[model samples]
Target: LPLKPTPPPFRNHGNFVVSVAELNRWLGERAEEAGAYVLSETVGAKLLVDDDYEQSGERSAGGEASGRDRNAPGRGRSTVIGVRTGDKGRDKDGGRKSNFEPGSDVVARATVLAEGCWGHLTGAALKGLGLAAKDPQVWALGVKEVWEVEQPLDRVIHTLGWPLRPQARFKEFGGSWIYPMNRPGETPRVSIGFVVGLDYADARLSVHDVLQEFKLHPLVRKILTGGKRVAWGAKAIPEGGYWAMPRLHAPGMVICGDGGGMVNVPKLKGIHYAIRSGMLAAETLYSSLKAGSTDFSSYERAVHQSEIGKDLYESRNMKQPFGRGLIVGGAITNAMVVTKGRLPGGHWPTHRDSDQPLLLTDRDKRYPKPDGKYTFDKLSSVFTTGNATRDDAPSHIRIQQRVPRELAEAWKWMCPAAVYEVPEDAPQGSEHVDLIVNPSNCVQCGAITAKGGRLTPPEGGDGPVYQVT
Candidate 1:
């Protein structure tokens, strides 16, 4: 047998890590090169829908779609035909500014949604089209930073159980990652980050602060001894595994990537799945368009029978056990791994992140203050993300101005971008607080959406301008 020659730049052969923002930019460039128009700063605000399924009574009296009609309804069987872009240049009160521009409609035969975790429009499409999964989607907040380090770490590292409480009652489940990002002729770099499940019961737990504490550990400190942080970012991750995945296709549209809950929680990997799902979606769309039909029922079948479905099904019960705490969850996870997910055998129900009740307690974990070097405050971290959000832009976050002290505390601490604040002037001894929202500080991480607030799209390109790798 003849052996195949390995490609040049062999180091890029195996599992590698790259800045997600950088990868996205390169992909966008590649897409543009392929004759696809890549719109920057534009946001898909509303789905242009057709009420054919509803008007035609495609659904039975029980709301189940009739044979071959897969549309389910959060409200009614509204078919997503395309998207409406969000209006720009709106004032804080939503008044048109001098430079105001009305949003435009972009019609298409098919629309593929690849919005990242907990996307606003994704929520709308999921409900409007009745594509929700059996189990509720869960989320975790990830705060990451890239640092220029003196000591170049060659291998990737993952750690668990220090900053987070391990007790089942705490409901804490997460870990941290450290990966080398060394580049030729450039200063040695490494990416360090931490993820915390949003289901934690602690009202004052801060993921950003936890990452700061993670860097202080002697083992982590050694690797980052002379490092200076160059970038910062935060995001929400959908960790609902297979059971939480919604229907992938609806009339005139298909959901792909994280928006479809394609992440494999066990491997902490979703990029490959996202890419693969996108490719499948492209194929499905192409075929549908070629056949002169908007019926994308085939897309759903294609995904379920594809590698994406197979991989997800294998680890279907992976993330649910974590809600019972790391100990029980880890034991079940180990059994599932050993038995190839056959041991669990059935669907383990999950809850939405916001459904977890946060308690106000004197036993809250206290985090160390940022040292301005290894550790950092939320606002300073936002600065590193190159956030250019206008101070006067309309608030895209939707939450009550006044909320219970416990909920207020949760939002204040949960936000890594410091968008929520319990004002200093809040009543001294009240059980409620006036929640002040600083939308300008938001990095559009979508974490708030997981824990009791809604995040809408800002003006096109109004959020953080992530740096290229």
Candidate 2:
């Protein structure tokens, strides 16, 4: 988390790391000083449209689910009036209780969305409202694990190559990271993980299972040999750069951070960009509200002219060529690097990760089994997360009621959480196996979305508990 960690040509340029705990504490002190009332356990289920509030009818909680979707672009003259937080007492399926009262609405002139990659409400608000930019958003799976070790590490480390098999065409698209954490008197801790692009073709390739293989390599295995894994977590990241950023503003709302695709992927950082964006959102909202207007183009103009825009524009085409696999991509990458990222990438069209074809195997090929210490299976990794899902929870993933056998098999291999499965009793190579959902085992890594099982938000406050990841 140092300003820069030897990434080629990478410089902090003032960007730095702050632990989430420190950031939260700082925000709390600031909020308390400013007399801001923070709601911790509430879920903002829907954004209310100013016009629809007066038009009167039973509208669904999310913009798209409701017949009247104000999130859709150019659909109507509806300003975002407020957001409706869900009632805490409602069941998993959202059934109201005997003493049910519709959740209260927080009416604000401006709402800023900082939701990270593929966030439920953010996705709905963008797609339903037709706000997506030229390129579709792409994602990569990043799994992190923390280990408590006896020796202190002198520096941070990052490495590329290995673990990814030959079947995976895009060898350069993923890599490993090892960041050391030192405490004053305690044992040194190392955070290790792998990031694999989701556009990979093989259905059997599991990011969760493969990370164990990454550990078995002598390089990573050495640091982790005597170390005890203390934590585990996973999240999808936005790989699309400026081309994928949605239009930043609408009537009464503006988006910032990951919700607006502010990540500078080539630099491998976004938090600092997010912090800057949040400040811009505040300024844009303040100006609009003071003028008693609903327009938010000021925010868009500011973002396009800010450092965030400059950074994204220069490196916009860097990742797109990698989709063609390592060799061809390597040639293009080197050219761009020499050209300083102004290679006119507009000619190379890019597509969503889901649009990539998946390579299917007949279900008998096997991967090396985990050896417990250097290697691990999926279930045990989920156990270390500490925020494991309840076994009885309702399924939160949305898929076809009766999925085709091929697609079902694909989903089983696609998810790193082991959230989908085929019955043991089903015949091997059979085309009739029912794909079952194990909602409780889910860590919500968002891999299933690439398999066409677009994930929906679980009941509020029901996801991962990050310890040191």
Candidate 3:
């Protein structure tokens, strides 16, 4: 069942996939047609700078003696050197050599950084230019797998839903889906993955664990039961939103794609944004070069005015940790769209209920010993119980409600006292259990022995008794 009052779908399932090889071929053909030189597997090591030149009226600091006309002055030329390693060679230090030698450096009026998530080089270049900012808050981990189903391929279904683990917090976003790309009579293909937030980085759960649980859901299971996994991998997505975007340009360079942290969460994709950013940067560079100006300020202006920038700006207002809410919202919306004609009135109904709590909590049962000992739990129980018995229970009873000392003490008693006991020789706050059935002619039961004959509760007992040491 789906909820009513949903937003319109902004994405089409057909627009989501393209093979890497196919993409590369298309790019190669386009580059050839445009008469642009294309280099593959080359890494940019540094941006070459002629510090001898100044910007506008600014003075130059590092002047080159012979490369310039000893007295002539203005801004000197600057270019980027992309190094290509040659096959199996040795450096001066005798380190193992690379496949290709340093490739010819490209001299350009401006440069664009379109490198994806592996942005080390782009970041390094920016740092050299003193334009990089601190690391961004937006981060995403991509987990994906392609599956071939045994059943006939029918209509494609793209389902987005949260994982099924208790520790899978609503704050750390996750989703699953099945897409039938091939025609009927052909085996269906599906791709599923999730992007979790880094807020809980230290306690991060593996995407594999989430995926396994997702495949077990009734809706997902039906489509993927007999499917054979064909490919799987994960990548990190930079999602700091518009606010996390870094300095788009400097005097001679601009950063794009993952290097600039440009993923738009609302769009469920980043390739379009990445391409648009790159194209705009290229346009600005083309214009600056044509005017014989190395300044790249226009690139930043262009990006901010682009469609991608507008989308990012609108999405920035939405809060972080886009988890279950997105999934629930997407599912409800998509269901309504697909079933619009089948339903009466041609639309789902809607209602508003202010009396409901967004999340449910169990208060009648005692928590586990470890949790019960926590002060928050002790305080919460007392306050909730009192509030429930009030003349008219408050419409919203928060966990922050204060608990009186007496009520807190009573609630503490309901929790096992053993949880609060400290062993005599435990240094401090150490827990130990000891049983003493006798004082004189003691049997000296080894099971009841503590660090220093300290007596505490036995694991299993029928009566309550107290002993002084």
| Best-performing candidate as measured by TM-score | 1
**Model 1 misplaced stretches (Cα beyond 4 Å):** 1-13, 51-77, 362-365
lDDT of 2 at 242: 81
Ranking by TM-score: 1, 2, 3
Which pairs of residues collide in candidate 2?
A: 71-129, 72-129, 73-129
Deviation in angstroms for 274 in model 2?
1.4
**What are the models' TM-scores?**
0.91, 0.87, 0.57
In order, the Cα lDDT scores of the candidates are 0.80, 0.69, 0.43
Cα deviation of 232 in candidate 2 (Å)?
Answer: 0.4
Model 1 agreement with the true structure over 1-469: per-residue lDDT tens digits: 1112421211233887888788998899999999998878898887777746322111211122111223343344466767888889999999999999998988888888888886666677655566777677788888898899997888877766678888888888998888899888999999889988888998988899989888888889999988789888898888887878888887788888999988877777789889988888889889888999887877877888998899888888877788788878878887887788799788787787888888765433567778898789999989877888999899888777788888899999889999888999888789888888899999888887777777777889988888843
Identify the runs in model 2 with alpha carbons over 4 angstroms from their true place.
Answer: 1-29, 52-75, 90-102, 166-172, 361-368, 388-392
Q: How many pairs in model 1 have backbone atoms within 3 A of each other, for residues 3 or more apart or on separate chains, i.e. clashes?
A: 1
TM-score of 3: 0.57
- lDDT per residue (tens digit) for residues 284-322 in model 3: 878888898777777777877887777665555332423
Q: Which window of ten consecutive residues has the lowest lDDT sum in model 2?
A: 57-66
